[model samples]
Target chain A: MQRVSQRPTYKTIVSVAAAVAIVAVILALGAQKNFGPQQYGQLVVAGLGAGAIYALIALGFVMVYTVTGIINFAQGAFVMLGAMIAATIYGDASSGDAVGLVIAAIIAILATTLVGVAVERLTIFPARNADTLTLIIITVGVYIAIQGVGLVVWGTSAKAFPAFTTLDITDGTLRFWGIVLKTQTLWIWGTTALVLALLTLFLGRTLTGKALRACSVNKEAARLMGISPTRMSVFAFGLAAGMGALAGIVLAPATRPIYDMGLKLGLKGFVAAAMGGLVSSPAAVVGGLLLGLTENVAAGVTKSGLKDVFAFIVLIAVLLRKRGIFAAGTDLERP
Target chain B: MAADSYRSDTGTTTAPAGNGKESAPRRATMAGVVVLVALVLAIGLLEAFQPGGVDVSSLTGGVITFDTTVRIGILTIVVVGLNLLMGYAGQVSLGQAAFFGLGAYSSAIFTTRAELVGIGSGLEGRWWWPWLVMVLGMALTGALAYAVGRPILRLRGHYLAMATLGLGVMVTIMFRENLGLQLDTKDITGGSDGIPGIPRLRVGTFEIWPIERYYYLVWFLAIVGILLALNVVRSRSGRALRALHSSELAAETVGVDTARFKVRALVVSAMYASIAGSLFAHFRVAVSPTPFDFLASLELVVMAAVGGMASVWGAPFGVAAILAIRELVRTRLDLVIGGAGGEQEAVAFGVLLVLVMIFMPEGVVVRVKEVARRWSR
Candidate 1:
């Protein structure tokens, strides 16, 4: 009885500690002499834009993980591929307008979807019955292989493309009250909101999306209901790749896409997904936004290089505070 | 995945039943030991035959060069610990390399920044200081791993992996950013250039230098690492780890301290990485944050997987196999592919990882041996 009673007390202490830490960080950042309220507001807005990208990627992570029960480490690579492919295609074309940007993005998304399906069919499908640890390792392998291919194709330099609908130069900045924002900020917000709405409708109203949801609920029962788990896994990967590509292409204009950029971005996205219980799509978006804001604010106060550190601290803290939130099923009994 | 092989090996060999059954594990372990001795001898012979160093071009067609061999020795030591954690204990750690980097950086700092750490400047030039520093580095890293693993081991599967990944990235960032500590506007972690001039190991005025002597020293430690790992897999704690791996809840139901065992595996593996890191610093006489980043951690996982997770004997060969592929690509494949500018190594390693996971999830060693046995019969 005492042991049972102690568990809740421990939990209460942990939650309280996490809350205090979050508040302390915000207070520390606000208290900095070099930072003014205007600067803080601008940082928050920038953090929101960056957080939206993370949310997009985290959504992809949630989709694949829900359906396939595998965290695609290659999700980040898809993001990189999306952005780089668009940049490369846009650079190669003589045309220079919004039409070229749209065409490039569609091509990049379609191509990345193919790569995602190939990854599943070639590496993941064969080891579907393996343990979760084995599946994670396989994803890591696929990630490495894809990154290598990217390195071979794009070399080691950072690549850039013009912002969507901007044609050639980055010359659109919006000033609101004392805060400055970019037009790309609007693009990120618009894309995320639009995607989330479409995703909600698809999952709630579409037959295929419902089938995919059934697969996530119970693979065996879903199979008995005449839905193929394999096909759903394939579809999930394709959808995730599409989402990742959307995030990558959208984010590329702000931060130049490099061959190895996917690793850090993917990790940050994973952090967000974990914080949101890994299964809830909307929660992941909220977690991503919160993580971005906290990281940017911490950087504003302390040092820029430690921003990733701050984000990871939140990850570790959230992970310890919660248990069994993300595990869909135990894969140990299977071969 | 490797739990089956380990159980069969140790269980079948040590049972005292009166049934007339040959001890397969004993025989296999004996074979493993013999092979390891043969490997060391082969290295000796190769070095003897080519006093002026082995031809790099000749070995480019999938052969282990001498330099590659020593590097593999160091890596094998680290991967053995990983095999215990991932293979036996059934845990995922994406940050083993960070522990390794911490070990290396610790040794580098202790040897180079003795005064900075407030150990006084008098012990700077002493040869024996490095040996003590290596021990300290291992201890400190083990403690850090223990502290970090307690909160993280409670997580299952992918959550555990993410937690560890975050821990690793944090370590790398700290190293790259010099621990955010500055002295007179200078970076404490050497600011990416890294700390150099780490003194080599010496025992009572006998110095180990010339790179080849360091080879024997590293291989000696590698053999010890392998033997120690085998012992752990066959012992009582080893049984507990295997049980925990099979099912943590089941283990707990049976009164096994699952969390304690998991943390033990993590800390032990971390200690292994720490020692290997110390050796790495002393061997190269420098410490850098580059090799301790996420990719290096991933590479370590790749090595362990290639070796077949539960097989202690398979890890060294896994190290050799992966290193040989890198050397082969560096020396031969890049020229043929019109120069991918060093990107081909990742390509080869990545392809190897995918193919190995798809075809031989149990690893190259166990699968190849099974086929060979079938063929011989």
Candidate 2:
């Protein structure tokens, strides 16, 4: 028992050592003579905003995976749907139309939630007993179907929506110490913090949230305790869909929402979740922020076309280093 | 020999009882051969009978034609490898297209961009250079698969899928960025432009041109792939894969070396994809990153799923069925609906995959065969 307990400590030490080594390398690169401090600051700001969005979507992945034991590939599609639906609703709104933007966000979130529920009922619920690989493939199918729907609904053109603020292109933008920032970035950061806080509170205080947690911990026990696992799983999907939509709606102002944007965004978030070992919410948030920062820094150093290349490289490196990525704290003993 | 025990362990239970209750692997291989011959004949007859552009005015303007059959043939070769990995080894990989792209780009680079990389002023003009490049491409991709499959195969289910997805995306980014590999003037992979004007493959005395002749070549290779896969499914390795698929622990207990079998399946599948990709490069006389993206990977999985994951003989049927439906939707459904855009085929495939997985996980091949046998009785 002592040796078994000590093994994970040794492994944890190695994991931390490897992570620190990577960070040291990144820091060394940043300290180069040609790399300006201001540029590094800019990268950090952009990374924070990007990481917030990733954390929101990663929360969706963790929520669904914990409750239903399935990785919802359509999670990214939900993000696209939110952005596109909101854009369609708030099309060409005037500068002062913040109320309209709010309404559109509400509608988009609700609509995406409905789609998530429909996916669970239509595709996932039917093949609930199938193997894990089959379920993942099914989600991939759902993702494709939703992308097709996005193409049909919005056509191939990209769409842009008004941000939550009245921040204009010039006067409303903030300039602090030669660094330019947008009001939308503030909104993104605030919304992410608000979601995380609310989620933490809900899970801690609310009976329904606790039931969902219980479902994640043990489905049969929850069922025996008179909570319907079906309802919890459905609720989990709905919650995840709402989070994904929120991320999309917030992100659309920063970058125009296109029909196929979900693929990359979803993949990034999944990578973040995997970094958390696919189970921990706080860890996923940290993972998202770290990924966003590292990718931004790497992109700043290299070409921007390889910005995403950094994220995948991190994923592979982390996956290789951590043999317990799929085992530790993921309820692996359930099966 | 242990194929029956493997099949039974997997709970397929759909294998029919023969007149003499003959061995399952032999029976399955014989069926595969029959299907291969029938497919060849059917494709031949279609090529001979289908109205060409000169015969029918409507057909002249359409994009889907006998060339689509050739595309299906090429894709059939790739999907056979996917079927073996997913069906027999019970491992899920979404990076098959990455291997395919690697093969195509390797062939393209060796044959066309050799001079750009300073490998060949004379080798590029050789008659057998492309063939050598193709073989080298297969070997490289197989080695890559072995390296990647080692650690990733340890992760079960969706984690493995996500890791492979990351791999696929990385491959695309590398191709898109050209890996910073530059010839004094331009990027090596040609970036989005890819490597165009790859020299067409040649036989001893003749260049393989004309769509019909290339179609035969591709189908011939695809048939060979099918036979090779059937042999693998009938061999001891096949049973070991099936055993791992059913229960890795049980297989391990029986001294099956589950990890080695898995890596073997992945290497075989990767080689199969690489060969198909080499054919694709030669046939198109060009190579690009566009066709081998994440979507292509998903489409390959869809082909495997729609055909039947656990059956080796389902690859061609899956390719033909999915492509035909896609062609129909792309050409005809747009005309009927009038406003659905060009993504209807993707939508149909998505729906088909879901429905098949939910209701008919055995896929079209196994289910149809079972029905036919029962009806004959």
Candidate 3:
């Protein structure tokens, strides 16, 4: 029986290897046929920008999942809320008021943070002892409700959000050797870096952050030490939401803000977080960047429409690999 | 002997000693028969009322339209399968809608574009073609589920959820992009506009139509689906599934092939969704990617959750409750809120799902049953 079981594992490894080889060959051939060096460079840059936003959203996922052991599906909705609220507050895109944009961004982050806290308190906290499946479904419910609220508030039409600054560059874009970089891309990357740095300091240096880390490591132990798991869970959700909102506002100019954009963005963020085994924040950031890069490059090489398919493919592949590539023997929490 | 031991074990551990073990199946059968009769009576009465120019919508205040009833019946089939997988087997497939889409697209593509796929023109409009397509779709979907579930079901909780969700999104993308086939030349799946002019199901010379007949057909299949599910719940395999749901290690220790059972549950559920999808395609006279998207998958989950996940009978109730709520919101919300644009139903569903799972995770049906039992005592 043991030998029989071992054979399928061997078969799985062979099949996975073949699949990877085939994908690599296809990507290479497609790149060779379609993209010049500069085009490749352009795709990479665009991928990095997108990856930065995914990273921030993924950071929120990592925070919530580690502390609460719940994969908050509504994390993406925070991004949507942030973008929609900021766009609403910033008023008409033609105005291009930088100060208004800044204020809108701040207010959006704050409001989204509160929304996140409320979601945790009202939905998650009450059902803290529910099974993982129930809790997961509850988060899904929260996501659906939040998204519905978004639709009622913003309507179905996509809203335009002006770039933070053009950097005085022509057409709000920089070109070098046929590679175009939008000024908004720089903002996304910069904001992502700042958030990451701040998160590192906060998690590493502060007492509250240390307490949050303690709870994630062992909730019972932390509780024994007088740290309230409830308080940390709320804080984690609020902080995650704020980060998600920031990512959303930063990337809003590039990808038009819409009512339902959260689903895709949130799923991609999940893919990123999953790549990190849903526990490691730094690993999640790296995973986000890698996911962004691969998705763009693959989409650029193949059909652009298959871009969404690539993220999911990556997700399934990572999941199948399980303890092989991303994290070593995490053994995800069983229901 | 194994069955006896399992029965005694469950009796001792889960239920009251003797009568609870025996009466449960009997009660389930009685409930199933009652539901089946009620559905048949409702269909006949509705059909009878049709000739008298009786507005069926007036009877139910427009909440239970014939069209909505058909949809509810179709969704009930899907939710029955979902209940088996999630409630009994304790496995989650967030992408059940993908299987539903697969079934739908299979019927749509083969039926609408029979000649394009190299089928003989003679078979294109034949009465048996759609039936053959639906069965084949179920087979294909089951095979796909088996292949996918083997690796995916190994991941426990969040990983499983994410993987299934990804599978669903990927399938939706495929449907939207016409499965990567060129839209300009061989527009087979019809891309985003979806395939229209799908033929109605026919029984030799008689065609099922006028929405009322289709409701009968849908409910007929839904009842069969529910009965099959109920039987599964009472069978040895069902006991094994429930055991697995409670504890995989314990189930394995008791000699249940846990992995195979999980895969089987997934395959069965996928096949159920496929048949329902085929019915939906034929009924709607069109197959679109929109109805089978991620949100649709979530809606199916919501139905299962709302009706009571653990009970096969909860499937129809859940579907009806959700559809009724949606219809209520759609018709009345605009009047109440002023300029409500049909998006509030999602909000209502979302809130309902959260509230139900939080308060009564076993589902409303089970909760009501418990409450009733307590009151009777």
Error of 3 at B168 (Å): 0.6
* Worst-scoring 10-residue span by lDDT in model 1 chain B: B4-13
Predicted candidate 2 versus true structure: per-residue lDDT over A80-171, tens digit per residue:
99999999998887766777888999999999999999999999999888877778888989999998888877888999777667633222
Candidate 2 colliding pairs: none
For model 1, the superposed segments whose C-alpha errors exceed 4 Å read A1-21, A92-96, A323-335, B1-31, B48-63, B182-186
Could you give the CAPRI-style class of model 1? medium
Q: On a 0 to 100 scale, what is the lDDT of residue A61 in model 3? A: 95
Docking class of 2: medium
Which ten contiguous residues of candidate 2 chain B have the minimum total lDDT? B1-10
Chain B: TM-scores of all predictions? 0.91, 0.89, 0.92
- TM-score of every model? 0.92, 0.92, 0.93
Per-residue CA lDDT of candidate 3, range B1-377, in tens? 01111111111134432354557556556766796678667666865676567556766777667678778889999999998999888888799999999999999988988777778778877898999999999999999999999889998877888889999999999998978665577787788899999899998979887776787888889888977887787778888998898888899999999999999999999999999999999988898899988889888988888787777877888988988989999888888988886889889889989999888887777778768779999
- List, residue by residue over A1-335, the lDDT tens digit for candidate 3: 12335455766799799979966875686767776678878889999989988988999998998898888999999999999999898876445466777889999999999999999999999988788778889999999999999988888999877877851213288888889999888888888888888888999999999999999899999999999999999999999999999989988889889999999999999888888777877788888998999899888887789999998898888887774245342555443
Superposed by TM-score, candidate 3 places the C-alpha of residue B307 at a distance from the truth, in angstroms, of: 0.9
**What is candidate 3's TM-score against the reference?**
0.93
lDDT of candidate 3 vs native? Answer: 0.85
Q: In terms of lDDT, which candidate is stronger, 2 or 3?
A: 3
Error of 3 at B322 (Å): 0.1
